[model samples]
Target: MYFVYDIGGTFIKFALMENNGNIKMKDKFPTTAKSAEELVAQMVEKFLPYKKAVKGIAVSCPGVVDSEKGVIYQGGSLLFMHEKNLAEMLARECHVPVVLQNDAKSAALAELWLGVAKDVHSATILTLGSGVGGGIIMDGKLQSGYHLMAGEVSYMESDFDTEKLRGEFFGRTGSAVELIKRIATKKNLTDKKDGEQVFALIAHGDEEANAIFNDYIYGLAVQILNIQYLIDPEIIAIGGGISAQPIVVERLNEAVAQIKAANPFHAAKPNIVTCRFQNDANLYGALYNFFIQFADEVI
Candidate 1:
């Protein structure tokens, strides 16, 4: 068995996986604020019970991670810094090998190994939540650029305004709790409780909901178009909470069709689909990373 941890801003999800890629047990905890050393100490305390059963550990983190060196250059939405060597700290505490990967890259690895991108040689996966995230795979390998920040599509310039698109959006909606605030504020409608409530309003055919959905789809389509022009992968998988909404997918497709019609490119458009693994993709990917790194000794 192997232990996997998917670390995020709000929560840290942990799981134990069998040799056959099945989760045996899983749990989650709120991610409290702490220094690098303190955080590692907390993780070691939480992971002690599973140490004897598992051979090694694999972690998926949201930031610029150096997979090979086990260093995190940045901890987006988390309380970490550039100099922290998370994997190294974990390895020291547990006396086992520790592997680390970007959360989006881990999700892509999961899809490539067992989910939608299983048969594809190249693909891109995008996660849209509080902010957009992405991963790129080429020739059956994850592509981390020179700085280990290749598939970080969120920071990509969507407008010539010099400010990042995500920064602008995130400024309005502080957390996932506030996504509806931006939607309601922009459309001059009363703020809903959450994203699901916004969807409910859309279901009722509210004009404000419709307009918000349309604008969201257009923004997403613009990013998709940028990705299309850059890597032009064989497939593009969209994941995150929004992916569960079929209306969002339909509107995104419509916008894509419009863009394709305007462009005269003879190249084949990338196949866009929803992620099959949903919220568990990162955890599964962490397990996959553990298996790949410790395959010989794991069994």
Candidate 2:
């Protein structure tokens, strides 16, 4: 058995998995802890009962992770996670070996192992939610780049100098949160409107909402095109909470088509697809990563 965790800014999801990839038990709770130590204590308490049964713990978190060393160089939305070796921190408390994997990379590994990219040798996963995160696979292996920042697509510049002053990068411009926020602000809706509320307006034939939705999809498509031109992966899988909406992939494809028609000189476009595993991807991916990291031991 193995203990698996997918740590996010708002929540920390953990599960116990059997060797055959079946989840024995799983649960999650809101993340109220502020620092690494507090988070480690929470995990230790949750994982204590299974300490005698599990072989090790696997963690998937948001950051530029030093997978080999089990350290995080930078944390994305979780500001307090920077420069923390969470694996070591957790291991010391639980008295079990722990492996850390970047959340985006872990999700990509899950796709490669069991989801949409199963048959492909080269693929990329773009997780589009509050922020855009990415994972890349080339030659049937995860590519972490020299600095382990290879698939950090959130920082990609979408409009270049136009929004630099506003810190509006691809993550902000191509995210569901940004779309909803923009629509809410433009349409004079109540403050703190979410994606569901904004999309409801679009569904009801609100012109302003439709316009924002179209522009958001356009930005995502262009970013996908840029990713294609750079890596040219076999397929680009879009994941995250917003990707659950059935129309996202369809609308993005339409936008890609429009761009292709406008820029006839650019002959190549990416093959885009949606992830099969939505919210649970990180958990499964963390398990897959654990297996890969300890293949010899497990086998």
Candidate 3:
């Protein structure tokens, strides 16, 4: 058996799974640590009970990760993790070998291993949640650029004229969560009436909802087009809570079409599709990473 962890901004999701990626058990807890040392300690405390039962641990975390070195160059939300060798830290405490990969890259790995991008020569996996994050697979292998930050589409600047939004990261503007919050605030709603209510308004042709949603879609379309010009991947997979909605693909494609209309530079179009995995992708991906790294010992 193997233990896999998907470390997110808000929670750390851990799982026990077989070598074949079948999860036997899973759970999550708030990620409240303020520093890397504390974060490592927190995770260690959680897995201690199962430490003896598993052969190895695989972690999917945010930031620019050097998988080969087991080091995090920069942390996205877990800012304290920058420069931390989490794998070494975990191994030292539990004395079990650990492998670490960037969270977005792990999701993409899951898709490439057994999901949508399977057997594809090239593809991009975009995880759109609170903020945008994703990974790229080129030549049938994941590409972690020199800085280990390839496919970080979220970091790109969004061209917006509004003073508040001007120069904002596309990751923030292209977020479904943000769109929901924007609509909820405008519609005077509570948490319970957030995502569904927002989508419902758009579905009912509420002009304000449609305008806000269109802005979000426009940002996405520009980036998707940029990606097409850059790598021309066969498929761009979008994974997140919002991707579950069929309208997201449909609306995004419509936005892409609007942008491509009579635009000479827009020669090749993007082939966008929803990812096979969603919220649980990182868990499966971490398991797959473990399977590949600790094959001899794990299997």
lDDT of each: 0.77, 0.86, 0.86
lDDT of 3 at 99: 91
lDDT of 2 by residue, 165-266 (tens): 544578778777777789999888887447777778877889988988998888888888888988999999999887887778988898899899998897
> Candidate 3, 84: how far from true, in Å?
0.9
Which sections of candidate 1 miss by over 4 Å? 162-179, 184-193, 262-268, 295-299
The alpha-carbon lDDT assigned to residue 122 of candidate 3 equals 92
Note the residue pairs that clash in candidate 3.
none
Report the error of model 1 at residue 40, Å. Answer: 1.1
lDDT, candidate 3, 170-193, per-residue tens: 788887788889988877777733
- Tens-place lDDT per residue, model 1, 208-241, is 7778666667777767777877899888888877
- Supply candidate 2's per-residue lDDT for 211: 88
Which segments of model 3 are wrong by more than 4 Å?
Answer: 160-166, 295-299
